[model samples]
Target: MSNDDAYDNSGHIPDAASYPPRWEAEALAFRHALGPRAVTNWSYGDNVRQVFDLFMPEDPPKGLMVFIHGGYWRRFEPGIWSAFAQGGLDAGWAVVMPGYTLAPEARISRITREIVQALSFMAETVPGPIRLSGHSAGGHLVARMLCGDAMLPAAVAARIEGCVPISPLGDLRPLIDTAMNADLGLTEREAAGESPTLLGRGLDVPVTVWVGGAERPAFVDQARGLAAAWGAPCEIVEGRHHFDVIDDLKDRDSALMRAILG
Candidate 1:
């Protein structure tokens, strides 16, 4: 298989094209139902994409959970993922869904920095332990925060309670040869600097590397590699593929939720 085929999540998932539209529709309705609880347009930077939507629970928040969306760091936005905030909100945690400039417009390094900015911005208002979750490229981004090079503020980094990176690309060097690299703009130099698995050390926050049992082999390898590197637990949800693996996140009582919230 070619490089892209190795990470071709959509081609293998049945009815793959329909998922985004369904997510978009669900997100629209979810935001609408939240009404005043859904705080829109909290800007973290000057760029248009540097805005995030904050979802509030009915009561005061218990803590903060930031769920980053993934499209290989090139697609999707905060608004398209509002529905995913349900599990966190219902569990009494304020959810922050932040948007960053996508690839081809912003390189991965810059995008990582944008996340740092977003994290600091969100932490300013919501006080409590901060947990993280992300899918695909988003998983990579969240992992970046724990790596030494991320340079997250000592104050903000210390508040991170745990991290759950779902189907993360722990190592970006392989992507350097993929067709998506034209858009991702990954390079050996950059990957060496950015790949979480290659880092010598990172923060001591509890990290659980999660991957769907049926996901592409590359993803499973990446997940195991991350867990091994960090000496964290690796949870593989059997029978789930890349796309559906994160569906568990919609249920507040799901194992995925408990793992991240803990």
Candidate 2:
């Protein structure tokens, strides 16, 4: 599928999966290449629903980058995206990838709470300011954290220096009309509560919204809406799509990486 087709209001998942074949292959390869020593699982709650993984650097790190993976808040896990750590690690940054309970099993509110708990664990266990980033569904979670909620525990909120959310779905109203809501089960009230566009106006922290140039127009619109609502900067990664845009992070000189590190 083409980028334009992916964003069509067809209300279908298969329609929006136009990520480049090479990107998907690389992501899968990276998931398989993870070394045992580089990844360690950490639990935020009593059971499996609270688990996360820390991707450590070979040398002492300059700062921490917490990555939240994307699967429309239903599928995927931290393990599948561990390969993303290579970019941050090479740049002397530690990476933390966390997983939250999927919808149907848990509500959006609970998922948000689990993210907070995961970050709290990181604050208590890891050192230094944290730079947050996420893709798609994960993007919304990271953006929501920028609200600097005292509920997160003051210390954790204070250590969050910046946030970067790529191809984020900031508004939830449209999802209610789309077939995607089958698993989300988002009522109007719950959808409003979870939308970053609605929650971002009160946020005081710095944020950079990014979208791949080749991403669906809806994704681009989502990024634009978030940046406009928050009064922050929005960046477009040239010739990239929802998936390949993340590869730019591996290159320190890439504009998206510069925005994150800047």
Best by lDDT: 1
User: lDDT scores for all predictions?
Assistant: 0.92, 0.76
TM-score of each: 0.98, 0.86
What lDDT, from 0 to 1, does candidate 1 have?
A: 0.92
Residue 135, model 1: lDDT of 91
Error of 1 at 227 (Å): 0.8
Number of clashing pairs per prediction, in order: 0, 0
Candidate 2: how large is its RMSD?
Answer: 3.8
Off by over 4 Å in 2: 1-37, 148-150, 201-203
Q: Per-residue lDDT of 32-58 in model 2, one digit per residue for the tens?
A: 565653655577887576788776666
Candidate 1 error regions (>4 Å): none
Displacement of the residue 168 alpha carbon in candidate 1, Å: 0.5
